[model samples]
Every structure is written in C-alpha cells, then in structure tokens.
Target: MNGNDQVSRCGYVAIVGRPNVGKSTLLNRILGQKISITSKKPQTTRHQVLGIHTEGATQAIYVDTPGIHLAQGDRNKAINRYMNDAATSALRDVDLVVFIVDRTKWTEEDELVFQRIEHLKVPVILALNKVDWLDDKAELLPFIQKLAARRDFAEVIPISAIQGDQVSVLEQAVAQRLPESIHYFPDDQVTDRSQRFLAAELVREKIMRSLGNELPYQTTVEIEQFKYQGKTLHIHALILVEREGQKKIIIGEKGERIRQIGRDARVDMQDAFESKVMLNLWVKVKRGWSDDDRALKSLGFDDLG
Candidate 1:
C-alpha cells in the first residue's frame, strides 16, 4: 500500500489510579494542557478529563479519572461512585488502559484497582510513575518486581510524568498496541473540555492552591459567564463552598485570597487565549453543596444524571 493510503493508528487510553497518583500530571504532559488539577490532596480529580494527543498518524485519547476508593458518607460515596463509573464507561470498547501507580508505595487501595481491571478483557499497561524523587534505582526494584509478577499486563513502563521522562516511549508503546484506524481527533486538538470549562477548572485550581486541603474537596468552581469582545476575554466565575467558615477563608482578609486567585487565574486565561483577560470572581456559600442534587447539577457534576 502507498504511504498516503495506509491507515493511521488511533486508540482510547484511560489513565486509572487511586487519588494523587499523578494521573492528571501525565495527561497534561501528553496533551500539553492543564485540563486536570494536580495537588498533594487525594481525590483532586472528581470528573473525567478527556485529553487528546495527535501527531502524524497517531491519535491517542486519554481519559483521567478521580481516585477510586471505598465510599463512606454521601459526598465520598458520590465522588467515589462517579470515579469508578466514569472509569468503567471510558473502558467500553477502548484500545487500552494505563494503570498509574505512585512509585513511593503500593497499598491495598492500589491492589483493589488492579483487581477491578483484571475483569476487563483488554490491553492493560502498568505505568509506575514518580521516579524523579528517587536518587537510587534500588528503591524502585521491589515495585518493578511486583509488576513483573503480574503476567496480566501487556507492558510495564516506569516514568516520571512531571519531568516528561520516558513519556514519549510510553506513547510509542501505546501506539504500538493500537489497531490501525483513522484519526479520532484533529491534529491541533488538545482536549475535549471547552475554554469555558477549562477557565472554571483553572479558577478551581487556584482555590485549591489558595486554601489548604480543607478547601479542595469542599470547594467547586462554576463559570458564571464567558464572553469575548474586541481584544479581551471577559469572564465571571463563582467559587462554591459548603460552609460560611470556608467562604471566609477563601475571601481572606481584605479579600486578598480571592485577589491572589484572580490574578493567577487571569494569567492562565491570558495564556490560554493569547489576549488580555478580564476575570470576575466571587465566593459563594452553598450549604452541603456536595450532597445537594441541585448544587451538583448547577456545577456540572451530574455525570450520570
């Protein structure tokens, strides 16, 4: 067959792991956009982020999921259920799944996720990440040996998602397993999330940084409005909190917390749009919002509903 007539390689890849395993970091590195928020806090990603990577004849669609865990209360139950459901939904008729595990250690939590993947009759690649924090290769041998023991994986590749080490090799490994097909996304497309969604996510990320871990799982961002006129991107957003005390912390003294968040979010918006950004932010109180059906719907958290 002629080179031009040959079919391209494309596939769906899901990066599944427990919370804070650097799944979002890997997605951003591959797709080259900040679609998912990264934090030291577990369960940082509460939704499925679709990241598209395209080059030449290879197009890889990567799905990032929140850490799957056992559900407890209404909020944890809701979040964990969404994560597991989203992972299962993304796995439908897909080409492969990348199981990301933190290099520091493996616990019962990690084993539980791997066990779930065992039932799925598809290619699974085990990606052991965060090698940069280690000065000794000897530190990673045990984990490597554990992976080798599992004959279930198609391949076992270790990488530092933050440093972009061996990421391309992982991509190439993914591409090698993909069945030949047409490109699923345009060459220039980076992610499935709209500019509006990304803006809200950026704002939420800022809030995650502004406040401590107390604010992350308790807070969410909604894009109130987004418009463009002349040379500026006009945007308004609301940061939702579950309690009044949380709102106070987010607004800070003399509104300094919100000010810092606004400034940082503005810079990211400008970078995304390549133009000046006019951003308006507000801190709103929504009592037990995570458990409120209306609140969840309003904030785009109703994935199943």
Candidate 2:
C-alpha cells in the first residue's frame, strides 16, 4: 500500500510525574535502552529527553520530562524553576500523556501533577510504577479505585519499569491511541539527542552516582571536545560546580574520585555508543552559576527563561 492508503500511527507521548517515581526508568524500559539518565536523587533529569520507539505500524515518540514537583526550600533555585517549566512545556501539543506514579504512594507533588493536567483536553493513562515492590498486592485494587475517582484517566495500569513488568501493555495502550500519520523519525532512530549530548549526560550520571549528598546537584557536565578517529573516540569534559569546596569534593584526595568517575563514565559511553572511548574529566568552580540565568543559558539550559 502507498503512504496515503496505509494507516500508520505516530505522535508524541509525554511521561510525567513527581520526582523519583521512575519516569526515566519507564522510558528506558519502553525503548529497551537507557536513553535517559536515572538516579536516586530527585530532579536528576534537568531536561526533557525524547525517546522514539517504532513497532510494525506504530511510532511513539516519548518525551521523558523532569519530575513535576512543588517548588520550595532548596528546590526554589533557578535550575529547579527551569526544570519545572520544561516538564510543563512537554505537555503541550502531545497526542497522549503517560502520568506515571509510584504504587500506593501518593504525595503532595502527585496532587500538583493532577492540578497541572486537570484542564487539558488530551487523554491521560495513569501508570502506577514499581508495583513489583509493593508489599501487599491486595491493596492495589482499592488504591486504583480511590485514584480513579480523582481524575478521568483513559487507563490505570500497574507496572514495574525497573523489572520490565507490564511495560509492553503500556506501550500497546499508548500506540493504540496515537493518530494516523507518517513517522517523524527514521524507524532505526531511538532518540532526538546527539551523541555529544548523551555523552555529557552519561558523565553527569556518573557524577551523580559517585558523589556524596548534595555534591552532584551543584555540578553540571560540559563537553569541551569530542572527536572520533578510526575505531576509538576521544572526549574531554569539564564538571562545573558553584563552589571551590564542591570542586574539592569531586576531585577527591590525590584525584582518585574524579578518576573513578571518568573510568565508569567511559565504560558506559563505550557500551552506549558501541566503541572504544577516551574520556578526560576536570572539575572547575563557576561560583553561583546555577542561580544565574545567563550562566545557565551558556551551559546549554537555554530552553527556559
């Protein structure tokens, strides 16, 4: 059949919820790849990452957004505001929204998410993630019943994104609702971001995983150079921090910690890109840059005001 005669499904799908609810994990599960970074820290995702999945006749472009949360306390920083706005913006012009939540765990931020999407005309599918960890499975039904009364959801699916449970069902549900249109991307393509962007994120992911409390949040990764020659790639990255003390924490005694971070990140980069990698890392202090809007824009967070 020709393009006009064949019925093809394609559209954007926004996955949103409060922090630490496994929004990024759900996206990685659906795509069967780690396109977005995940961490135990709330607000690990500072930008809206796009992951596209195509099956037989359906294409679902998933937008993995920063968790929507109440902006207060230390979370009231400029970067936090930028993350909130980016997540909110992903809701616009989408075919469907996958509202992910933790199983039987509802917080004030969940209520905030409800309020954000209450007036939207789009269809929402409530995904209760991490059901595998639920101690009492019998409570699932009652919880769904109570949540159902709060909003008119298209479907309420209980899933475990980390364990790869019921994610296919969620994928099928999203695919069925998408409109008939040509695919916006090639079928082989999985994400809208380039390798350089993903590389920087991978480095930052290592920073988040390695550092002690609060140190990672004060840091951002920037790729000074990335070049490929023959079968190997060379990368030079800088970790930007707000204070000299934070820089010292990252570098560690005798530069052991930063070296370990670079080693781990390079291994991950090799696996993700399927090539040998040479990663060089440096830590620098940019004093109070996270709060400075102009500085944030220079660091590639120009999407928000």
Candidate 3:
C-alpha cells in the first residue's frame, strides 16, 4: 500500500531498568540518535528523556528514565528521590514497557523494577541486555526461561543494546505492539527535548565520563547562554558542585581537566547542532543543592512526580 493509504501507529514505550543496564544505549540504538546520555556510573540518567522514532507508518515514542535505585541514610537525598520518582512516573500511562536486565544477573534493584511494573495492564517485554558480553552462549536459554517464569511477559528477547544485536528485532516487536494512532511528532523529529537541554546534557555526560565515581554524581550542568551568531552556536555552561573541593576536582590542575571537558563537549555539540560551536565552561560551588528540595527545584529538578 502507498504511504497515504496505510494507517499510522504511535504509542509511548517506557524503558526501565536498574543502574547501568544499557537502557540509554538501547534507546539511542532504536532511534538511531543520542537523546539520553550514558556513563559507567549508576544513575547517569536523572531525567525522563523522550526519543521519538518514526518509520513508515509506525512511530514509537520511547521514554528513557533514570535507574530506579533504593535510597537510605546518606543516599536518601532530594535528588535521589527525584530520580526514583522520575523513573517510576514514566510508567504511569505507557503503552508498553521494555524491562532491561544485565545479562543473567538479577539484583534487588531489578526486582524492584519488576515490582513496580508487575501490576501494569500493558505488555512488558523483558530485554536481556549485554548479551554480547556473555562468555558462554549456552547460558542464554536457561536464563531466559528463569526470568520468563517470573510472570507472563509479552515477549522475552535477548538483545545486545551496545552491539545492535537483535536490536532491530526488539524494535520490530515494539512496533507491532504500538496502538493505532496518529504520530505525535513529525517524521523528521527525533526527540522532544530542545537544543538547550541537550547541550547541558552533553556537558554533563563529559563530566560523568571524565570524573571518578563520586564527583560526577555531585555535579550538574546549566546553560547560561545559548545563541547563534553567524554560523556558530555559542554556549556557556555552568557546572555546579556542592563544595569547593569538588569544584577544584572538576577544574583540575592548571584548569587542564575542565579544558579537556570543554573540548570534548564542543565536538559533540558541533556534531549534534551541525554548526561550529564556541563553548565555554565554568565551575561553581552550590552547597547542599543535591539534598535541598528548594535548591533542586531552582536547578530544574521539579518536573518529576
């Protein structure tokens, strides 16, 4: 049938998993673009990123969420609560849920995610991510069978989000389940986020990748200026940390580390914006911002439930 004669299908699909389970990678692979940032650290994704994929008559809007983790004692910060809420809230009305798990390893966090979605009326596809990293291919079927017995999943598919193995099959499975409806985004559109948000995210991604375990979680990026002059995109990002020590760590000796971060971020911005980028970065101390509710709200963390 011609394009005009076929019916369009569109729906929201939520990708949920524990920290560092390749949820962002899967979304980027499915959409063939990067909307969600990734790092080796847990909780790298702290917000709900929407990636839109339109193919022929099917458009799947994917919500890539933060890793749902337990918070207690020192970990029970306002930001942690925000992250958990953001992750769970994405499940409210989604048409389908792609529950990703690290290959053959189910932790308490994975069980927590399952508990949250167990009662949902929508179809849940259990995606076994990182299958390419598995040493023994013989373990696949038994692991699949073990998880499949947890509940009645619509489909239990093994996929390697990083290697693009079975990713197309996963996308096809998602497309088949989408409801018949008009596309919410244009065929050319890929994400619901703006360039300003993406610019800040790219900077944050660099920080996450550059720093050690603890510091990246203590930092966030804010764009002070984003404008176009001639053929260049100029951006000024403010990196906020909770202490002077943290600021110094990000800045590094003789400002070399921060400069490297800027250089990396600028390249990504240029590629994403398709324009020359004049990027500037600065680090500041915002004490207790990560734990203070008012500070978090002021820093644009108030969108979650």
Candidate 4:
C-alpha cells in the first residue's frame, strides 16, 4: 500500500430516464466534458456510456444508457436491452440510482423507471431536472408531490441540469449514500471511455445538432485513427450512413454542410483531446446499418459486446 491511502468509497451510479430528458447533457456536465452523445431528438443515445468521477474518497462510476422506450424493431429492441442492462447490472452492487426526470411534468416513462428499479434495495434519488423550463413554482410542486407519493425513490431533489441549478445539492445527496469502499479509478480519471470513443461521440453530437432528423438516426461516428504529431493531433473518422440519400444530404450543396459539420466536430474534438487536431472525415453508406447485425456489432452496439 502507498504511504497515504485511505479506504476509498467506490460505487456505480446509473442515470435512467425517458428519451430526450437530457440524460447525456447531465453526464457531460458532471464530467466537465462530453462522453455521451447529446441531441434534441429522442433516442439519440444507443448504449451505456460509462463516465468515471472521483471526489475525495468517493469514486462514482456513472453509466449513461439509452432512453427507455417501448420496443419495436431490432434497433429498438437492442436499445431496450442496453437500457435494462445498464440500470440493473449496476443495481446489483451499486450504491445509487439517479432516477432523472423532467420537473414540469411526470409521464408514464418516469413511472416505469421507478417501477423497474424499485427493487434494487439501494437509494433511488429522484432528480427533477429541467426546472429552468418551468416558469412557475405551482407547475412543479404537484409533480414533486406525485414523485414523493410513489415511495419509489429515496430523495427527490429539484435541479436544472442544463443550467446546473442545485446540482451541487444533488451531488451532496448522492455522495451521502455512498458506502466507504475503495476507489475504483484513479484520481484524475474523468470518464471511462478512451479518446477515440469521445471523438466519435463528438462527431455524432455534431451530426445530430446540424442535420436534425434527416440523418441523425441513420448515422454512426467511428474514429478510424488518432495519432499525435509535434503540436497537432492527426485523426481520421468515418460518418456511417445507412443510405446514399443520407450521405448526399450530409454532404449537402457543394459539400458546404459537410464542411460545417467538420468544423463544428473538429472544434469539439480538439477541446476533448486538448490538442490542435488535423481531422480527416469521410462519409460512407452501410445500407440499413442499425438493423444489420454485422454493422451493429462492428460499431460496438451489439448486445453481446
């Protein structure tokens, strides 16, 4: 053992909520960097993106999974599987479940989140996010009362996740539940994903923000290469599309849209990598990629993987 190493407090924390509830946004804020893909559209996140945070003696491993929704096609089925796995897997040994929800209203999905994980036998903190959207206290009070009646979560804290209002309060609430275990990650570890994964996720977030529905669901970001030069980082990436039409749409008139996307994505990737990046971006068609087992597996979206 080192000369000075106290017994660490390490445990997992899963963020579960409905689609478009700003789950990815919350994780990115906590990490002070982007690890999960964020979009205004529903169902943008596809898998459990792990983010590691260490504070004093506590190490909270956050698992940001896809939104919980009813299953439909194979893609939807896969997303459901990912959400269930992320929530319950950590429930087995985790110290907390942050049941995130919108503050303005409570929906069936929110109820489902409580019902699904109520048996975890650990603390379930009902984090009422997006309070900034609520203009009146009366509008949020009933929702909080409803959540309290559920008897499903341990504590309900109102917070504006995007604006970061009362986030410190929520953090303190979560930290209070952590057991005195050893730290699972190093002190400086901000997230569990590598640089390449974060680069791809940045690209994906750019596509979702720039292209909207036209190409958001049909796309996947893959980092083909990441290398270091003297002062700049050399990177190669592929924007996987399922159709030729989507590719053309992404490229846009005279490749203007692609250039815009590249600029935006490169800026974010550079900030994430902390180096000037020479990014090479290419768009390719994978033909119904989300449903194709091989393509999904290749992109690390498979159930087994």
Minimum summed lDDT over a 10-residue window in model 2 is located at 1-10
Q: Candidate 3, which ten residues in sequence have the lowest lDDT sum?
A: 211-220
* Tens-digit lDDT track of model 2 for 251-297: 99999999999999999899999999998998888988878889888
CA displacement after TM-score superposition, residue 155 of candidate 2 (Å): 0.5
Estimate candidate 2's alpha-carbon lDDT, on a 0 to 1 scale. 0.89
* Cα displacement (Å) at residue 206, model 1: 0.7
Using alpha carbons, what is the TM-score of model 4? 0.91
lDDT of 3 by residue, 1-305 (tens): 33788778999999999999999999999877788998888999999999999999999999999999989876699999999999999999899999999999989999999899988999999999998899997888888887778789999888999899999999999999999998888989999888999999999999988886645477888999999999988899999998888898899999999999999999989989999999999999888889999988887897763
- lDDT leaderboard ranking: 3, 2, 1, 4
| lDDT for each candidate structure | 0.81, 0.89, 0.91, 0.77
Model 4 CA deviation exceeding 4 Å by range = 1-7, 73-92, 303-305
Instruction: Report clash pairs, candidate 4.
Output: 8-181
Using all chains and alpha carbons, the TM-scores for the candidates as numbered come to 0.93, 0.96, 0.97, 0.91
Alpha-carbon error at 195 in model 1, in Å?
0.8
- The number of clashing residue pairs in each candidate reads 0, 0, 0, 1
Kindly indicate the candidate among 1 and 2 with the higher TM-score.
2
